[model samples]
Target: MGIIDNLEAMRAKGQDSALMRYSLGNEYLKQEQTDQAIEHLAEATGQDPNYSAAWKLYGKALTQASRYAEAVEALNRGIEVAEAKGDAQAVKEMRVFLKRAQSALDASG
Candidate 1:
């Protein structure tokens, strides 16, 4: 079965696992299916809004889809959440992504 099919089955089974959703999204991303990646990543983030990795991937997908503004917003939210949780590593990584998003926005403007 395809990855999406598996993910659908998992979701139907009430397995709203953030890591599973993130992995599904990563698979979609590997196939260059940005829309699918975005959808799964969004679900992952919704399941665990404090999931910095999901947020990072979501922001990357958004940026690749040329949703610069949304990418910046997602990255910023990730940074804030990480900081609030005192996740130093996540915060540091999110700061890098935030900088990239900010640069992209600046270049677009």
Candidate 2:
């Protein structure tokens, strides 16, 4: 079976967690399916509000979909969650994405 098939099986087994949703979201992002990625990533973040990785991916997916304002919001929240969790790497990475989103907004405006 494919990656998505496996993920679907896992989900059917009630193995739904933040990490599981994040993995599905990342896979969608890899395929450039931003809407699907956003849906899965939103689930992940909802499952675990402190899931910095999910938040990061969510922001990126939003940016890819040309939702600059939403991307900025997700990135800002991710940065805060990362900082509070002492995830230095996550914080740094999200900040870079946040700058990209901000730049996009500025360019459009």
Candidate 3:
């Protein structure tokens, strides 16, 4: 089985968690399946609201789907979480992505 299959099996066994969802989302993103990625990433963030990485990936998936407004929202939340956690790197990266989403929003208007 592939990575996704293995991850799904884990979930099937009631092993689901924020990290597992994040991994599944990351794998889906790697496959360019933005919808799947978004779904799992959203769950990841829901499962752990303080998960900066999940929020970042969720924002990225939204951005990839051209959901600029949602991307901005997620990224802003991720930045806040990262800041509170003193994760400078994550905060910086989310800011860059936030800028991209803002630019997309501007261009579409």
State which candidate has the highest lDDT. Answer: 3
Model 3 lDDT tens row, 11-64: 999999999999999999999999999999999999999999999999999999
Q: Give model 2's TM-score versus the native structure.
A: 0.95
* lDDT minimum window of 10 residues, candidate 1: 93-102
- Using TM-score, rank the candidates from best to worst: 3, 2, 1
Quantify all predictions' global Cα lDDT against the true fold: 0.87, 0.93, 0.97
Q: Which residues of candidate 1, in runs, are more than 4 Å off?
A: 2-5
- TM-score, prediction 3: 0.98
Query: Each prediction's TM-score against the native?
Result: 0.84, 0.95, 0.98
What pairs collide in candidate 3?
none
Task: Estimate the overall C-alpha local distance difference test score of candidate 3.
Answer: 0.97
Poorly placed runs, candidate 3 (over 4 Å):
none
How do the residues 1-109 of candidate 2 rate in per-residue lDDT, one tens digit apiece? 8897799799999999899999999998898878999999999999999999999999999999989999999999999999999999999999999999999999998
Angstrom error of the Cα, residue 78, model 1: value is: 0.5
Model 1, 56: alpha-carbon shift in Å? 1.4
Clashes of each: 0, 0, 0
Model 3, residue 63: distance off in Å is 0.5
User: 1 or 2, which is superior by lDDT?
Assistant: 2
